[model samples]
Target: MNAAIHEFTAERLAGGDQSIGAYAGKVLLIVNTASNCGFTPQYEGLEALYQRYRERGLEVLGFPCNQFGSQEPGEADEIASFCQKNYGVSFPMFAKIEVNGDDTHPLYRYLKKAAPGLLGSESIKWNFTKFLVNRQGEVTARYASATSPEAIAGDIEKLL
Candidate 1:
């Protein structure tokens, strides 16, 4: 297994592939998001956290996923537009990627192994599942779909 998250890369929602290494030394809240899920509203809370702690080095990275209930069915453009218009999301958003099964993104694969879910399960259960990584690129914690972004502020504060 890779030693740190900086070893991975993902496609940006807008265009082009981005190296995760670019975010080295910055705390990351990586989340598997969806456009039609109940947790979709969490975008606002996530943006709030980003705005609050961004200058302090906190980055909320949103990765759209369709593995759960096919909740995210739009193309990259649609997803980007929806996030901006509905929630005014300004954080980095990535192209839709599979969170489970054979096609799971490498970044997610590392995250699951670094911080398994309840009962040591590595499979992501659903959309909006979050993984917190420290500035050193170490996977620190994993939050469930129901856990609100606001609830993670205290944890983020410590890392910052």
Candidate 2:
């Protein structure tokens, strides 16, 4: 497992700390999400993808972030409610976090470093930016916010 990623811990929306290390051997799709963003609807696609591949070892982790235009301004409970009510998001959703700036979560910092964006930029350009991690906890690819979750299914199948 990648030491950097495994070393981080995040609070689950359900009110508990979860060690990233616990997901060491699972393929992971880590996304920085926003409830009110235009790509918010991607939650449906993401949920579909997760449901389809979760039994095959895929884990879609969502981290709500309000850093983008105050789009995800709800508290953990509210965010959880919105996701369940609107998209039936059943995968693990984490407490709100900052995906960019000085307070960026350690996991996100490592992710950006592991998979820099176009032209080697490390900053997350928008919400829903995704980091695909292999079973060994290595960031294999970074998908832009505009890339639909379904569009990455084939690639995920290869990793599986």
Candidate 3:
């Protein structure tokens, strides 16, 4: 899975720099999140998943995205505050990024390539689109926005 996800050095929403490489060898749920979208509440379930299985090597990585209907329009600080105060999302979260088109973030670009959408489409349909990466850094599944976190508990449990 080398080069599947381009290296990135981005600030965590919590207040520090983090390298994507630090998460290697872990099962990762990479989600493009939005604080105002219909699926925004998934943060609660996501945090639930993280708190439940973090010791078992499950990592939930959130990348706040506003490209979908301006659902998330907040500064980095505000976004971070929202996540912490509202959902208790202790999981890592990055600054807002565009997940599709020519200016797509490097990490999203790599993920989309690794797991193409239906009919081979690379574009992300909406917020909350999730990419589940296995221990070997390969994307194992792509869950749409409507697929709630609790719905995938069984799959994550097996991975753990």
Candidate 4:
């Protein structure tokens, strides 16, 4: 586990501060999401994974991002409503954030550095890019936007 991740924090969509330390010792599927993107439907699969493994120490953390074609243009409440009404999402979701560029969230900065994408790229390619973290908080793998949530179940199971 990298000591840096635990030092970061994010604002919950519902309003409140969330510390990465809270998920220590838990396997995490951290994703950069966009509500209106073509990959938006992946929310259903993400929720399914959360429901299936949450009891086994899995925490699926969603972070909305509008960086990709202004896909997630909603406010915090709207994002919350969209997730709940459309996907029945019950996992923790954070406020909108930048996954790339200079203003990227501290947590994301650490994640991209820890698990660069294909060709060793540190920048996020698109929304729904997922980062798999081990129970100890070390990033084990990085999945691209085209990688369906179900496709990573086997890797997650290994972590669990």
Relative to the true structure, how large is the alpha-carbon lDDT of every model?
0.94, 0.94, 0.87, 0.94
Candidate 3: stretches off by over 4 Å: 1-3, 14-16
Instruction: Write down the TM-score for model 1.
Output: 0.98
Error of 2 at 115 (Å): 0.2
Per-residue accuracy of model 4 over 82-139 as CA lDDT, tens digit each: 9999999999999999989989999999999999988899999999999999987788
User: Could you give candidate 2's per-residue lDDT for residues 9-124 as a string of tens digits?
Assistant: 99999899999998888899999999999999999999999999999999999999999999999888899999999999999999999988999998898999999999999999
Better of 3 and 4 by TM-score: 4
Q: What tens digits encode model 3's per-residue C-alpha lDDT throughout 54-85? A: 89999999999999999999998899889999
Regions of candidate 4 where Cα sits further than 4 Å from its true position: none
Point out the worst 10-residue segment of candidate 3 by lDDT: 1-10
Error of model 1, residue 58, in angstroms: 0.4
Q: Could you give candidate 1's per-residue lDDT for residues 1-160 as a string of tens digits?
A: 2346898889999989998999998999999999999999999999999999999999999999988999999999999999999999999999999888899898999899999999999999999999999988899999999999999999999999
* TM-scores for all predictions: 0.98, 0.97, 0.92, 0.97
How many pairs of residues in model 3 come into backbone collision?
A: 0
Clashing residue pairs in all predictions, respectively, total 0, 0, 0, 0
> For candidate 4, what is the total of clashing residue pairs?
0
Record all residue pairs in model 1 with backbone atoms less than 3 Å apart, i.e. clashing. Answer: none
